[model samples]
Target chain A: MTNLTAQTRHHLVTARVENKAGVLLRVAGLFSRRGYNIISLAVAPTDDPAFSRISIVVDVESNLLQQVIDQLDKLINVVAITELDPEEATQAELLLATLARSVEHDADLGVLIQSAGASIVEMTDQATTIQLVAEPTVLDDFEEKLRSYGISELQRTGAVALPRLVQL
Target chain B: MKLTGAQALIKSLEREGVEVLFGLPGGAILPVYDPIIDSSIRHILVRHEQGAGHAAEGYAQVTGRPGVAMVTSGPGATNIVTALADAYMDSVPIVVITGQVATTSIGTDAFQEVDTTGITASVTKHNWLITDANDISRIVAEAFHVATTGRPGPVLIDFPKDVANATIDYEEPGELELPGYRVASAPDERSVAAAVELIAAAERPVLYVGGGVIKADAAKELAHFVGLTGIPVTTTLMARGAYPDAEALHLGMPGMHGAFAAVTAIQRCDLLISFGARFDDRVTGRVEDFAKGAKVIHVDIDRAEIGKVRRPEVGIVADCRLAISALNEQIAKNSAAQSRDRIATWVERCLDWKQRFPFTYEGAGTAAPGDIGRIKPQFVVEELRRLTPPETILVAGVGQHQMWAAQHWGFVDPRSWVNSGGLGTMGFAVPAAIGAKVGCPSKMVWAVDGDGCFQMTAQELVTASSERIPVKIAILNNAYLGMVRQWQHMFYEQRYSEVYLSPDLPDYVKWAEAMGCVGLRVTDPKDVAAAIEQANAVNDRPVVVDFRTDSMEHVFPMVPAGASNDEILVHPSQADQPR
Candidate 1:
């Protein structure tokens, strides 16, 4: 048996479900009934016919992932599920944050952000909006990397993914 | 005519052309329930208030209309928060109506009284606490308009119990006037010009289309632009089916778990034209390395989205369809090199990459002699692909199997693939499949689940059986939550935890049979085809095919989140080796 806490690794998953009513309930019910704490989730349908894709990011043991997959398959309208390989997939997520503009003028703050892979997307007198697109871990690193520059408000788009292989 | 707030609520809903409302009846909502019984609107009694909220979300998502969810105040309203937040993040249009304590009991902490409006304020697009019956009609109308318009999201309207019962002379409100809220429609001239110039001058350009195209219903226009400009396109997870998956220029999803070719293209492109896509973390690992060579031009309807990621060379705050149409018009006038050769080179590169590390699974065609055998998840996905129609909707639970589905399932259409992509909800498949089956009754729907996740809400199988929703469930029973187990094996020195379910297998199957559903257990790989065939035969009720798979199996081609996309872990067992 895997040590639940010691073996657990956080994963961010995004799925596309048919754009129908009640699908979200079914998805959430599955997690809650199973006593899974979903750290964050973002769901929306694609531009295709009538389908909605939900992105759910959570933490669990790697050894027990199969059980999770099997349980997910039981949901009626869930068309497909993908547990993104943090190492192989080209994952990107959006973080829309409004930082106090007072710090934007700080030379130290400007240098800190530039080093953290973020840029000032918008600047207003009250807030300086910064945008960062990176892996969840890197984003975390960048967040820690930007502690010197205070963050007033923040919003994340959660994670979305595509594979990363070079074409010939 | 004089009417109660409840009656006005119903009228407002009817005026907005809402035919169905997903919710549950409770004490606080008795007044609304009374009027609902007399109204033409049909109410679906969900098993849980949370289910009602998600159901409304599903309805809104499928129909592109505002979903209506009604419930009692306090816990009922609170229970629906998850779905509300889900809709909020995904931009789904849903209106949640809750019954509050009587107006007289404002801050007295009456029985079942809670500050639901304040509780949901951060999660909803807008929320209102109505104390007066006369304001019901206007509030309801405005709620629907707000929820459906702009970047669609959930809206909440809390009605006091007395307000629902209070009688008043009602008249539909005039046009909604919210001066502070304005979604841009037309593209700014300078940005459009800059975008056109970027597209015209580029030797290698890519159109990163997103759900906004589908949201705007601009598929034809998007397709037209891709065809005319010969620019390759890649979609975000939410933008699947924005363009035909089979299109020559189409590079599949680009992000964590997206196609490699798409990522490489993003990395190598000279110019990137983004339509309705916000740069999320899953798509941009090590942000500085994201699209290192490209000049990005972002066009979106939400002004807040512009420059929300990498600073765009040209940021146009306008509807994608309008922007694309305007660009098409301008491109027609500007005589510039189409650069067909460059576009062709990129396409060739993508095709070559796809041929290299093709998303596939290898089966040894061997099974151990036991109740739990070595059945590969890929075989199930592959077999289902063969048996089901190409357009069949396949939903999956979160875990190792979900990754297998993404790798093995050949998605021919957009929306054909659905799951909890961002949240990674494990037990999402069964109910999502039910919703898909409900949305497209004529189409085949399959809920691909794993053993651990399947047992989470297996009770839903009873609902499918009783409701006569013929959803086919293929359980990838690896006995443990495989993804978690793999992590334990690789990172934690294989100290197994709660991942094993050796004693629970038989009970799970027995439970399915008791629910009046046909249950088939597959211990042998050879029986996979037959089991699927038998499950398909059960048209009257839901069918479960439990394939006992090897617990040691793992999802490969993994790119650890913080690492660069190029750094991949090819297999679960070999964690130290980077591909």
Candidate 2:
């Protein structure tokens, strides 16, 4: 059985695919059927309207990375695939958290949020919604700190990545 | 021209030169069926959707064209799933068109509605759920293109009821817009040169061929290469007829249930030249230990399959025909005299093994010690082969009977043998035989099936009878799930499980007669040839012959599952004999 935890090695695969119905399903279906764990996934239209780029963080054994790439490459809708190495790629994630608001929670949380590069997006009588745009690891840390303030709801937009600009 | 999506679908099929299609009608697919009636293509109305799918596979295998199957939504779509998976596993080209609920009601739990595209996505090479009638022709063209190209497999198009009913200006699809889909073209010159070097250097080499050779229509090229090099060739189950069985350099088959010489030669060979054959677990036995000493030259059209199993020393991603032609060219240029001279002793040794450890059964003409009123399946298969025309197409169901038929029947022509090799789907023979017979009406087709397999989809014989297809069927009725029973007998200390299905129950002859077939039952080994001759004589309709074979007879030269090929078990009688 494959280890599905986050601690296992994660391969960030970015696939440019035709922007068509059921293409995402086909891509996701391949992963599920093959029993490969998806740590995270993000999809959006690329610069070209005809194609969409899907960023997938797959938790797989080291030896199976080639298989993951090969299998993904077989999908008819997938135009191209590139494994974005962490050192050579830039990744970003967005995290939103709705936390309970009170005098007791407000003081220390403000300092923590500032240090973590998070901002208060919305404020209400009983709750405060915070937004964080950072690397996945920083987002994870920011989300963890918000947990102590009695979180009501939270969501993370999975990481999206691109190759870093090469120095000429 | 203005046309409904249904009309466009039929026109597209006509443009694709589809002569016949297997299908069943249902509410959601009624619109498409309406157009099929007026189309030039002959539509075979199969009794069940599964039969339709398998029949399409049969047609594709024999004709080298993508088999077409159509079925309705929901239950009908689900029924064909097994056949689709079977085609996917075997890389048989087929296009399955399934009806879906109207686009408006697709997710509203409409009547006879299911996610046909989603259900089949994994099993198919590619699939589409049509939303526009305008795109019907293009999708159909693309579907055929995908199904028949690069490691050909099944493709599907889920046609919704509204889309079928909608009108549009029908136009031929432009050049296929599939940028991502590309087949392996000519191999790298470096890889080809490297492979040729390996071929010229290795003293002992075995040419491992698979079904891809048949798919690529490369048997002639493969034969020419083998002839030039004098390399021993072993055809896998899917490749039984790819290489002529009577060739001097032919090793029968490799892997589990393969000929001893074939399996042992692969184990002992120094060079394993895999031509279009995936290193399937069934062929490799145990991956780590299979051909441990051999350097591999793997050539296949599917890039994913090349290094997916065994890492080859020289991997060439090219069509088998092209790859073989390239190798032959290089070999000619290199003049492999030293290689041929060095491998002479090795070739002689392999041929000796082939002559000595030939497939044999104990008491072939008589029953085993305590089992009276029974015939050995091998004898029945051998007699069937002898009685039938050499060019006859033999379709086999999965089990001991299938192995028996494969071992006993000598196939010389390509596409003469069709069996579910990769998936090992039982109940495949009956419908597939029907399809093969329909595709090649001039040829004699026979479905050599097991009783267990016969029970699964035997109703398709009724379609055969009603359509006046004269495909013969030989049911090796051993009154048990023969293959599973053999496993229980060998590894499970003879603790028989629920493998027994009484031979008398349902009375196969009566069942055949009920289905409008001329039924014959053979209890004596002497009567086997007579029964087959009688079946062959009846050319008006299908015939079913039930040969009451011994349940105890197991397929020999068995490489125990997951065991090393070096430890292959030969026949009990041949066990412990001097090498």
Candidate 3:
């Protein structure tokens, strides 16, 4: 059987858009209308209040990368688009997980959390909440390991990336 | 000066050189309509909002200016969505101003209120919803600028009721702050040189032209480029009038119902040079197999369109005129001695194909005097072509009559042919013809419509009559949705389902007369010319000539849906052979 997943590559594109109502929808609408698969999307205000930055990760072939960029550039609200190389760019994501807390597995959970570089943010008699900020791949591993403790709730901020600064 | 947002909208349009607009007013748009009476811009009140949108498109198509349309929120805004989509698909520059509910009541589901901006986001090239009265002038200016520039397309501006009623001190907007938007007009010399090299070395080359040529006003440049290169040109449906049909190099339109020579030329060419035309599915049937032997050279202003379909060997992102001019200069400078002798054999072969498989119907121009039942649609188109002047503008609605008009009308002038090429919107003829006549008052405009299509928006003729637009209408009455019926006849075991729109519903002649138009009916084949002449003579009012045509007749040289261009069905005899 052929694996459909093997044929596709993940692409990260960061775009600066006008900070205006309906602008985000305009950008998202282009992807949806064209039927481009958006794997993850993260949006927030930029340093300049007049503009917002949207980081989108899409599953597409290499041939369609330029088309994606070109289409995004066509939108009036989209100010600029930059494709960040996953290998060279600095990428990060945040994961928040609420897990059941019991005396029997408390020591094991504590050791697991410390080893995975995750910090317990809240503690209750019934449950414990942990937060982790790391590369998406690392968070995926940590989240998988946390599932053994019975994760009640989990939330993830999709990856945000920026090009690494070059040494002078 | 202190002015309401509505007043500023009118003043801004005047500043943008808008002389005419088409619209119908409703609740939310009342304030904007009030300013129209005092404005210098003449507004044509249409029966429906859809009619208003199409009329604007027709105006823009002929005048090479941004056409304007206005409507209220909710149903009114939704009604014009088809026209907006049509303009977007065809890249016709138009500005649509739709009124919305008061900003306070935007999300409350207020009366005559809908998310106009949200609904039109995908359809428009760009749109804006004004929250402040101070931003009206700048937004209006920006709307026009965005609509007309680069790859021209439709733009919509949604005006909330409260904003339109609010008064503010008007200040002329400063320089446009579209930092992201830029039009690349300068031709890249390296790409131009490469294209020229391809032309020189190519054994058989065909210039696949599209509507962008006319949109770019590059018809003259295109003519010069083809003449210099000695390349045969096959214009697309949207680009019918971009190249003169009488020119020796013109191979006619290439698409589903294209001429045999045009279809075959694209299929057979060793190199395909696309100028301002996207390789649309209608043009390149079964794209994988389309022009398998050809190396593509695509030049369009929109970079997104370059490799979106078939990847071009040499893709140049620049205006068609600038690119063509650059190519012409480089070719002239590089090879002054190279004559038409290089590609002479290939040209002769194409011309031979054109001569052998001419776009002709049986009994064309020579129908017997009393042969009333045998009148063909192609014959009527030919009669109109024969009777009208070369410069007369021809507009068509969707379906068989559209294909026939595209095939028969030897359009020699750019901007002389208008139709919904990409979207194939029916009932585009009457309103578009009215718009075309309004834009080009001195030029003759004739709308060639089909029976099924004519019934869709025939009420627009009333606007044409009341406004004294004086456009002519030729309804090819085939009594059925002819194109669909033809497909059913050929493909679906001859089971005609739901395609038969009755022959004599709402008697088109009486419908025309009721709209204050001179109605002429031609059942006899011999009266075709006289009827057309009579329609042409009525310059004071609109004229509708109902030409009863053969319902069984099919548009020939058709590339069946999703089939390769190589397997085109040229005639009925070829239809029997299994694919």
Candidate 4:
């Protein structure tokens, strides 16, 4: 009714392409060439695959966003394409780990982080590592709460999502 | 097949295409020097170890290759840490090789021995202490790979003396095995769509571009995005020349000491799209209030930068070039366009702000009756800009002169404008100029310095003259560290610290003359041009022009420390009477 396109919470796009040289160049080239920013991407080979499957998470309008899928399909090695919605399909998770400097020295801080769904992964004299997997906002809140405990270093892997149902 | 660790190091360097090294010779690193005699690698012996580090920075900046510098352990390595830090902060790719005391001497508090690895850990991207001869080739190869890859930065390899002398079968350099690190090239599409939506909806938008664009070579894509969106763009100090100043939408630098128009536009924007920029303190003054009215969208290659400061309304952790292109596609498909009148209104407001607070200097109103005929710093910058060709690389000593150069000079190429932007190190320009001249021998390199900064490492003039590097130095001799004194005068109630060096000036000029270089002193404003001309004429040897500038003149458009970007002390004009 507003005439403006309604924004979706998230989008999932799967691209199957050759795992050859500059395949990255072509894929990245397509996105950057179009001025698109991918939020989360999981790239790996499928079970029957001579080709690689690239799962891309992007927020875009339905019509123009379909063009990206078509473009990915046009790549010489690209075999197929599928766009998934988090609300309808299964969800994937992204893992983030941050090394905390003190644990026993800051007991309440450690308990507070665990409350945010982060588990103590590793502990050493210099630092303790806390691992978390959740929505981006939860990760943000977890990192923010742990800051008072002093974070020495941090690392996060690309988001990996799967369909909630096993059916293809 | 057996060779000394030092020999393997040299061989690995040769394979890496290293042609020159800048460093000082010391006891621990003598073995490396021995191999240098036979190798094709040329070593430029600097007067000081620190000069060697900055020289490497200069070489790295110009060549886009990893600059190599060699130094001995202990004081030698410590001396070069400031330069290493400068390279680190600026993201200059440099490979620093230092010699440690022999293996047996470890933890003995041996003479001339210090923990070079520990000393440089924070300053280097990656570093290793090679205790075994067998690990030499692998470590050297990995150092080069690490230094030149991803976001290029300085890497160090601390070679123990005994390890350098020890012999083993040398293996050829192999593929680098860095499993944890991979430079992100593709953008996440969801983030791109969100950014496009924000861009399409916003009435007043500003594109804040930073050095990451130049580093990733995404200038063309960035320009195209700006063109399509018709959004005004502002760069951080490091991102100068990414978008040409002559471009219609380019608003120059923003934040503390930035253009008044840029700061005002950023403050008034409805949305701020940050591309490849780390929101540094200097750029984002008091982060909480910065762009308070806008919905911030930050796009960078590094995920660590997303929520570091001033939480973004939409944070896209992807390469700017890729992200912008994706967003452009979405916008094109949707055909979502904002009203042209809104853009026009913002542009008119920006123009009005520029007119109100123009950056200018008016010669102290014909000079006071008893004025000592001091040269104005602005005149020095203007004269240098006039005399030099557009391609001339201007390197500056950190302080008032550096900021003045940044504000005044309109750089036309990426990497053409180089400075220790965040580090703000004094005594940087001379050696850096030499390195720049060495890297691009055909181009004219000018080392702009202040009297205070020039004296810090002015001894390198001897090295410059001896090497016949032909770096023309224009020293803005205000006889005081102008920036510090300005802060003291404005904020500290004029209680000047040890900033003056008047009576000691004669000794420095005499030293320059003694070092086989021509030294000219300019007191009157008219003599400034003639002195610069004379320095240009002496191309065979390095020339130093000492322009005695006014001690009281201050750099305007200053956002004092802890102040918001919107608040700036604009230069006093004719109507506004000076206190």
Backbone clash numbers for all candidates listed: 128, 0, 0, 23
Better of 2 and 4 by TM-score: 2
Q: What's the candidate order when arranged by decreasing DockQ?
A: 3, 2, 4, 1
lDDT of 3 by residue, B39-140 (tens): 999999999999999999999999999999999899999999999999999999999999899999999989988889999999999999999999888888
Better of 2 and 3 by lDDT: 2
Question: Which regions of candidate 2 fall more than 4 Å away from where they truly are?
Answer: A1-8, A99-108, A123-128, A141-152, B364-373
Please report how far candidate 1 places residue A134 from its true position, in Å. Answer: 44
Candidate 2, what DockQ?
Answer: 0.69
Q: lDDT tens string, model 1, B1-579? A: 999888888888889898777777787788889888888887766666766766576555545667788999888999888778777766778899998999899689998889887677657777777877877777788788778766677899998988888899998877663433455688988888888888888877877877777677777888888877888888876677678776767777777666666776787889988998877777776677888888999988776566645778998878888989999888878767355765677667766765554454444222422234457787778788878888877777788888777656666765566565555656667765765666667878887888877876566666667777788888888878788887788678899888887725556567778977887788787788888888877789888888877777777656567767665454433334222
Which pairs clash in the backbone of model 3? none
lDDT of 3 by residue, A1-168 (tens): 014463246788999998989988988889999989887899999999999999998878989999999999999989999999877899999999999885235899988888888888988788889899998778878887888889999999888998988889
What digit string (tens of lDDT, one per residue) describes model 4 on residues A14-82? Answer: 676655434555566667756666766778776755666677776566655665675565443455667
lDDT of each: 0.73, 0.90, 0.89, 0.77
In candidate 3, which residue ranges exceed 4 Å CA deviation?
Answer: A1-8, A102-104, B336-339, B365-373, B573-579
Scored by TM against the true chain B, the candidates give 0.89, 0.98, 0.97, 0.94
Chain A alone, model 4, TM-score? Answer: 0.75
User: Candidate 2: lDDT of B67?
Assistant: 94
Cα lDDT of candidate 1 equals 0.73
User: Lowest summed lDDT over 10 consecutive residues: which window, candidate 4 chain B?
Assistant: B363-372
Candidate 4 residue spans exceeding 4 A from truth: A1-168, B320-341, B363-373, B503-508, B574-579
What value does the lDDT take at residue B149 in candidate 3? Answer: 92
| The 10-residue segment with the lowest total lDDT in model 3 chain B | B570-579
